[model samples]
Target: MSVRWSFSWEDEEWLATRTPPADNNLKLAIETLIVPFGRSWQAVDNYLEVWRNMELEHGAEYSVSTPSAAVERISRDTVEIGDLYDQFEDVRLPVDEFVTLLTDLSAAMRNQ
Candidate 1:
């Protein structure tokens, strides 16, 4: 199957307030990631809603991986990091480091 990868805010608030990426590859990457959760944007949104609620209530973690069963831990770590950020605004790496990490992650996902 062919996949398109792209990135955009899937939430209504962000969607209303922000402009989507103009870069085609970035857009494709975001779309590719959303496909496994569900093939439509709305499905991804619904999953995110449930996921966020689970994180809030029970600190649940979720992962997205190719092969559908590889059980990668990075996504789980990302969730935990986000939780940490919510609890402690000062508990974060530098912006450049965070960007590099995410860039590497996106590369890995693309390779998969």
Candidate 2:
């Protein structure tokens, strides 16, 4: 089986998402995109910028927890908005797969 991004409703977590997130995995779905858009604007790279930066980041420098250090932690190929305090368990994806999610979604949205 493979995984894909999605905007969902009617889940056990739906009610919790309504009020606020206690920190959760950043799902790169349409609805999930709205979370970072509304809450993490500083970290939200524009769609084009996300792709542009991918060419710049060279190595896999990332963390499993929310980013708290004073480093340029954001990678061009990765969206490492670690631990958004909306839920538990950070969702980690391979760099290429992660970028594919953003690119594919971007294309789909453009077509619509």
Candidates' C-alpha lDDT: 0.33, 0.38
lDDT of 2 by residue, 1-112 (tens): 4545432224322111211222343432224433433333233346436444534554445332223211123554454444344443434345565545545444434443
Which pairs in model 1 have colliding backbones? 4-28, 5-27, 5-28, 5-29, 6-26, 6-27, 6-28, 6-29, 6-30, 6-31
Clashing pairs in 2: 21-86, 22-85, 22-86, 23-85, 23-86, 23-87, 24-86, 24-87
* Candidate 1 weakest lDDT stretch, 10 residues: 12-21
**Candidate 2 TM-score, C-alpha based:** 0.42
Clashes of each: 10, 8
TM-scores vs. true structure, each candidate:
0.29, 0.42
For 1-112, candidate 1 gives per-residue lDDT tens digits of 3222223345421111112222443323333333354324444444445545655665434433322222122333442122211222222223233233344334433443
Model 1 residue 78 CA deviation in Å: 2.0
Best by lDDT: 2
Give, for candidate 2, the lowest lDDT window spanning 10 residues. Answer: 12-21
